[model samples]
Target: MWQIILKRENEISLSRQLFYAMKDMILEGQIRSGEALPSSRGLAKDMSISRSTVNEAYDMLETEGYIVTHQGAPTRVKEGLYLEKHQKHHEEALFPVITLADKPYKVDFKTGQPDVSLFPRYVWNQMMYKSFEQLSDKDLGYFGTAGYESLRVEISHWLFRKRGLSAKPQDIFITSGTTQALSILVTMLSKAGLPFAVEDPCHRGLLEVIENSGNSILGISVDQEGMKTALLEAHDFSAVYVTPSHQFPLGSILTAERRIELIRLARQKKFYIIEDDYDSEFRYVGASVTPLYSMDKEQVLYTGSFSKTLYPALRIGFVILPPKLHSEWMYLRKHLDVQNPIVEQAALAEFLNQRKLDKYIQQISRMYEKKRKALTTSIYECFGEQCSILGDETGLHLVLKIPGAHFDEFFIEKCQNAGIRVFPIEHYCISKGNHMDQLMLGYGHLKVEEIQKSVSRLYNLIMDTE
Candidate 1:
């Protein structure tokens, strides 16, 4: 007699369950090779199930090579189906739990993160709903890699109005984010084994993108005036990447003179300049700085992302390419994930067309500016004049420099143990030993009270270490 148990109460189809049970028995050697299985009619009668259900299970077993069946012939177990049971490995259970603290960190100064809670959910939901309703059948299909045409057009218009830059819709290519845009640009522009020049204390993630492409990177140091353009002439470069509007960690605007000098060098050396205009939308100071792409469109690959402006989950960003590079860009983009999803793109296009994004940016900028002030005020109050703040004029984070204080891994780890999280400027440096006295603190996502308390905690931690 067969020992097959059926679970009629289970939600799974009877055929599937029977199939799994039979397959397991075959693998476990309970059902020997070449052994004939029970007839479909007899098994159905014995189990009180339909003959078709038993037939379906047998069909699946035969299809998977667990059993073999032929016209008017017995269904026999396939040969060599047995497999040894794997022993359970519980090695991970032997490890001790190392607790930093009982509770979560008092503060986390994570950079490049915006306050997503303040986003207009209702309005955005409305845009998404409308987009879903209005999208033609063709829109839901594989749209072009160049991106939603209407969204591109709206982005072009918004750029002119917001940043005073002129970009054509045809030349704009949508990407998942600035990260993806940078990765593709690095791969495309890397030439003949020539290195890509980048700011020394650059965004580590962006640096990795260039490094992963198998191209050498030339780390040009940055200062209070941004990347040292004078050092760029020492070697031949395929392309140069710079954050011109507001530098990443140090937060310095690329002065007009330095911008011109960099462009001149690129022209003379026949290299392209990748201008990453990330997080310039929330500038709390004077009018936003002019992008380098506006200066020389032919040689500058301008990239921007809405992750900081809107929400990080939006995953919508763009790069402005010259006519010569458009074909290659499409070819590369096609190979990399084919294209981003269509619903989000359509919703974003509608959102841009209605100027909802402009309104949201205006609303959030005021709040972020206030948060920035709270952070600066707290830093000044905590360490007084001993700690000076840098790059507070714009962006969600600022550099806090303590003249004699060295912020390293040990200091950061100690702070983390005390339930506080802060990053060192040196963490982002390509060449170590520089920016040892500076710590990077992001405040755009923190409340005023949290900023004050976190700064106080940070102050105590620093004093205790000293």
Candidate 2:
């Protein structure tokens, strides 16, 4: 009799377990291909299982083409079912698999991280459930890759109301995030032997999207007004990438004059301007700055993400493409991921249609403003006159500059060893020797208590180092 044991107490049916056990044994060559299987009655008697259970297992095995039986012949494993036995290491996991969970940091101030605890998950979950229940059967099948149209229209409405940028629904297409948008953009914009003009000390993740795509980068220096638009040379780059609303890492808004200069340069050179309007919402001061895309939709290819405003795991963002690039973008998108999952898109569309997103932004914006204040106050208390905050206005994170304090690679390593995770502005720089006196502090995810304690610890660590 075949040595097949079934756990009656197990949640899975006995027949399923027996079938899988036998199938695996056959595949692993434990039972050779073409080997005769024990008769159902004999297996039942040997294993002490009911005859019906063994019969069901045998029937499944036969139905699946794993085994063949003639009216008068014994049930046997099919040819080519045998595979080499896989070697197992004792050091490797064999029992119930255990997965490692991320260890909680004593003080985590990671950038672009929103406070998920404050997100209106109950409402979102309800909307998600509703979308699932309300989505028609046809709506689930082969939906166009351009994204849910309702979501695109909602994004268009949001841009006008929130960012003061007017884009038609046709111009706005959904994306996973800025990363995917950039990934597709680099391919479309790349030209032979031409470099892309990117801000020096930009987000590392963004820098890679261009570099990893085999495109050369033109590292332009950034000052108080974001990328030094005055230094940008026309007819040189394929496209100029900028975070106009609020700069990344350095947190400076591109000046009105500079933005105009960039648009003119792009128009003259026949190049495009890739505007990454990351986290334009939640401005602490007056209104959020007008996006460069707002100036000229033809020249500026706009990208925006909800990673900061909503929870990051949502993985929803969008790009505004001019009519010229629509077909290629659709083709690329169709093959890329073939569109985002319909449920989340539908839920988000409902959320926007109902203005729950508006209410949520209002709630979280206040919390972040408070957190931003806590960080700045703690920094002042800790370092006093020694440090000054960089960047104009608002975002999730800002640059903390202690002018005299030298922060280098060794300093960063020391902090890591001390269980403190802090990123120096230099870490994100393409050209070195500048901004070494600064550290990037992201406070969006931190509570006031955590911010104060972490800033205090950070001060002591800096003091010890300097």
Candidate 3:
């Protein structure tokens, strides 16, 4: 009789439970190495289950090298199958429960995240449901390495209409998100043998991504106009990253003259520009500012994402590669993720085709614009002449500069105690000792009332620090 008992009502699948039970026995040496396992037919009869179910359990063990079998012979536990048991460390649990937000902050001005509650989930669900209703054999199989071609075409048109950038569908490739696209590009662009020139006080998460790839990052100073291209004429670099549409932390648009200057520098120095046009859709001002990719397609690798606009979990973004790099990008992407899931791509394509995305962006822009006003007005009321706001022209966040105030970790700790969580601009600086007096406040996800309350709390924190 089989030693293991099956649970029919458990949430875990039967085959997986069976496999785990056998694996535990093997590792504990209760099932001795070289001992033959009961035949599938015998075990199935003992357990009152189908032979196929028993065979599946054996197949998993065999595939994992836990057991061995020869032609026309019974399966036996592999030698050295026993593993020494170690006491479980609570922190080392396979799925340890980590607290994402332990502190009950009254308001968190976290940047680069949108209020997704307003997204039209009903419409999106309908589109996704339709994709499954008409699912095809090819769609469920290896559709292609590049991406869903129709989605690519739709993205190409969307970019053209939204940002005035014309790109062929063949050159567009889908990725998991903006980070993946930039990560892949890091590998491809590293061959040029020069450090990546990035903005000095740029996105810290992005800097971590570049550092993880073992690439050197050279800091380019950013002014009110954005990535100071004039700083690049002296030093050589393989590539430069800019948040041109609305700069990252600083939230300044790259000026037209500087945009042209960047293109000229890249051409003259033989470098590439990595434009992260993230959150451009929510610009509170004029139509989304034109991207650098529009100035020169061949030199710029453009990245855009649907995470902020639709929802962060969508994990869908695209990159427009030049014709020359298409082959390498395709090979690398195929090996990395294969391709993005088709169901969402199809759903997003339908989302774009029906002009729902355009309407969604329009509505959210107005909502965020009002939140931005509330935030600035609150800052003025609280600190009056003590504080100044920058980069309010666009983006979900703005820079609040408090002159003569050096905000540091101590200041942040005080804010935490007061039930406020806001980030100082110095945290994002690659070169420190600068921007210690400034803080970045994101208002897009905060309600009008929350913004008003958070700013007042922030003012008190600043006052206490001084």
Candidate 4:
């Protein structure tokens, strides 16, 4: 009898273990093709298992075409079933997974980080409880891929009041976050196979989504007013992605003239504009910058996220899609995770209805403004006239530009080695060498004292490097 071991105490059934053992032996050529397997009754007697268990395992092997059974003869291994055994490495993992705790930086200026401590968790919990209590049987099942109607309506209202953008509840499709929205949009729009256009120095993670789809990317450089729209006239694109509200890394608002120009070109050239309204709400300056979506709702796909406003784990965002594109968007979204969870959507709806989010934004904006001021002040104190801050008027982060200073990979590594985590603007650039003298500093999650101390440490590191 072939050597067969069974562990009755194991959670796996005896039959499964036997099947796996036999299959391995067959593949490893220990049991050659056309070789006869022992009869079920005899194998069961040898292994001390029930006759039925052996039959079940044999049945599986037969059904899978790994073995063939004839009514009057023994089960025989199928032809071409044998596979050479490959050597297994027993070495320990060379690269251990690094987590947030691994690289303990004295100060980290990671961008797009929000001060989660300022979020009203108790209020949100109460809302969540209410949403759960009110859930109907229908709510637990697949709600529409478009998302909860109540949440959409509330979002519509919030958009109108805050951004002055009038969007119908039907047009607003709820997503897990802006990242999901971008991924789906990239797929939907890139069907034409035309190159996708994005800011040269754009959000790296979002850029990867488009790049991963195997679509050609056109990197349009950005100036103080935003994307260099003049360069766009030369090429045909499937879509153009821009952060008009608050340009990432550089922190420049796309001027009204450029916004109009983009809309015009999108209309003439027949390309969709992706407006990522990142960090648009917490403007420290005069007023929150109007979204490019407001200018041309039909031409622009507007995306917004509550991840920075609330907590990262909350994972709620939305896109205001045009009506003509809705059916296709829904089809793509249905195949990609169907829809978001109902409880969070319902809870967020209630939160919006009660004006809690509006109040929270107002409260948090004040605190963020203070942190921004402190960060700028500290930078001035440390680097003096050599360094100038950009994009402090809006967003949780700003760019620090030092003329004649190259914040390349070596500098970034050196800073990290010195217990500081600061990101250079060039890190996010699609086409490098354009922005080599700047660094992005996120102060939203840091306390005033932490900001000051981090700036001092950053200055010391820079001075040492110089």
Candidate 5:
């Protein structure tokens, strides 16, 4: 009799467990090739299981070619299936343990996280449920890579009404977010062995996309007006990446003269300008600045994201491409990720069509305005004219320039040990020593009480270091 045991009350079927155990033993070479298996009746009697269960397990093993049986003969293990045991040494392999959730911080000043508490979850859930109930069988199947057509049409109308930019639905290419849009663009547009020009101290993630793609980068300087286009005369580039509406980290609006100059340079040099109009909808000033795309549609690839205005988990963004690049972009997108989920796209289309996005942005804009005011006042009270704030007119975060103070790695560690979290401006720069005297503070996610306490703690940390 075979040494087979069966637990009849196990959650897994007895036949499945028996088949797995026998298969594993054969694969591991514990059961030698050509070894005869016991008969179902004998094994069943030894294991105290029904004869039918043992027969089913043996049937599976025979079906899988693990064992061979002839008419009225015993089952024998198949030969030549043993794999040599060459154990791989993973001693040199390094696995990263750091994750976003594991990041240690007390007063987190992380940027780009919207206040989730203010999100209209009830309305969003209703729309989502409605979309699911109304979805056709066609929606569940593989849609086109460009996106759901209804969403594209709705987005076109939304863009025209909100930003005054006339974008056709055919020209719009949907992506997961601004990051993926930029990533795909870098792959598609970058010329072989050519350098790209990017604004110095740009969003580090975007800059990384260019660098990791092996495209040489020309770091054009920027002042209060954004990306000094005068410096472009010296170097040739494949394209220029810019944040025109509201510059990243620095928050300087590109001037009209510079916008014209940039377009002229792009045409003269035969390169494109990537206009990242992120967070333009939340402008706290007079009117939303006209995107650089307005000056020349053909030369600019405009990208916009809903992460800031809407919840980040929405994972929706779009790129408005000119007619010439449209075909290539579509091809690249089809091969990369196939397409976004249809359910979210369908729901978002309904949301945009009903003008829910418009009302949502208006409500959140007022909340952010109040938060911005609270942060500004708190900083003034804590530092008392010793520190100056930069780029407070718009966006979720601002830079605090402490005169004669250098916030380096040493200072950052000390602040962390004291439970204060802030980013040094130098952390985002490609060239060191340029912005060592400033710290970046994100107040969008902080409440009035939390802002006051965090600012006071940060101010005290600076004083103690000095």
Candidate 6:
């Protein structure tokens, strides 16, 4: 008798279990070629299973070519099925586990992360539940390739009230986030073999997305007023990506004149512009700058996201495309992800309609403003005249420019070894050595006390290095 066992009580069916056992045996050479399988009735009696179970298992094995059966003859295992085990050197490589202590720093100045502790979870949860309960049958189904019409309407209103940018709901397309929106734009706008221009020390993630899509990228130099439009004029590109509201990492708002120049260039060159209006909702100073999209909706593609404002996991963002490009965007979006989750879209629309987003931004903006002040104060107390903080006016992070200090690979490794996680601006630069003296610090996630400690630690580390 074959050593076949079946457990009818297991989650897997008896037939599947039997098939697996038999297949394993055949593969291991236990059941050799031309070996006769026990007749179904006999095998079932021996294994204490129904005869039909055994028959089903045998039928599956035969159907899969694992075994061949001839009428009134043995079931033979397929020939040439055994795979020889190859002998090779197996080396266990030990990689160094990077710990914060290895760098030994008191303060971490990473940027872009928001303080999750400050989020109004209770209110958001209530909205989420309410929206879920009110969802219609049609809402559960694919609404449209564009987005939830209600959410689009609300976003249009939200942008106008918050950022002073007026956009039509018809022109808006929802995406997972700004990253996905930018990614789709890169694919949608890049003419055959044409290059897209981006800021030199731009957001590294956006740069990677454009490059990975096989689109050419021209890096334009960025000064205090954002991307030098003069540099852009000299270059020929299909599209130009700019952060007009507030430049990332460096924190410079694109000036009005340059904005006009960029729009003019795009119109003249027959190219498009991608305006990433991220983090502009948290501006503490002058009025939130008007998005470049307002200047010329025809040629500019404006992208915004809720990750920084609401929460990162929400994964809700949108793009404002011109009327001409709407059809192509819808086509690409249909194939990309089909559509975003309707529940969140419906909930977010309600949230905006109730003006909760405006209140939330006002609340977080105040909190962030305090954190930014604390960070600047801490840096001044520790570093004295030795260091200067850059771009402290806007955004969640600032650049600490230490004079005569070159933060190269050796310095970065040294900081990591000390438990301090600070990013060198050079790490973000496409062409290095230009920003070697600057370190990017994000204070949005750090408490006022943590900021003080981190700054003190960084100061001591810098002094020791000198």
lDDT score of model 4? 0.90
Give the per-residue lDDT of model 4 (tens digit) for 247-292.
9879898998898999999999888999998788898789778888
Q: Candidate 5: lDDT of 111?
A: 83
The per-model lDDT (C-alpha) reads 0.90, 0.88, 0.87, 0.90, 0.86, 0.85
- Positional deviation of 12 in candidate 1, in angstroms? 1.8
CA error at residue 397 for candidate 5, angstroms:
1.0
Better of 3 and 5 by TM-score: 5
Error of 6 at 153 (Å): 0.7
Candidate 4 clashing pairs?
Answer: none
lDDT per residue (tens digit) for residues 251-366 in model 1: 99998889999999988988899999998888888888889899999999999988998899889999999999999999999999888888788888888888888999999999
**Each model's total of backbone clashes:** 0, 0, 0, 0, 0, 16
Best by TM-score: 5
Pairs of residues at least 3 apart in sequence or in different chains that clash in candidate 3: none
lDDT of 5 by residue, 165-198 (tens): 8888998989999999998889887887788888
- lDDT score of residue 277 within candidate 3: 85
Better of 3 and 4 by lDDT: 4
- How good is model 1 by TM-score? 0.93
The candidate, 2 or 3, that scores higher on lDDT is 2
What TM-score should be assigned to candidate 5?
Answer: 0.93
Candidate 3: minimum summed lDDT over ten consecutive residues — where? Answer: 86-95
Candidate 4 RMSD to the real structure: 3.7
**Model 3 ranges off by over 4 Å:** 1-26, 30-80, 86-97, 100-103
Query: What is the alpha-carbon lDDT for the whole of candidate 5?
Result: 0.86
**Mind giving the per-residue lDDT tens digits that candidate 2 earns over 1-466?**
5566678899999999999999888888888888888888988889888999989998899899899999989988899977765456643556546778754666666787888888877999999999999888877987878889899999999888888789999989899988999999999999999999999988898788888999999889999888998788644987899998888889888899899899988988899999998887889998778888878999999999889888788889999999999999999888888888899999999999999899899998888889889999999999999789976368889889998888898998888777887889999999998988999988888887778899999999899998
Collision count of model 1? 0
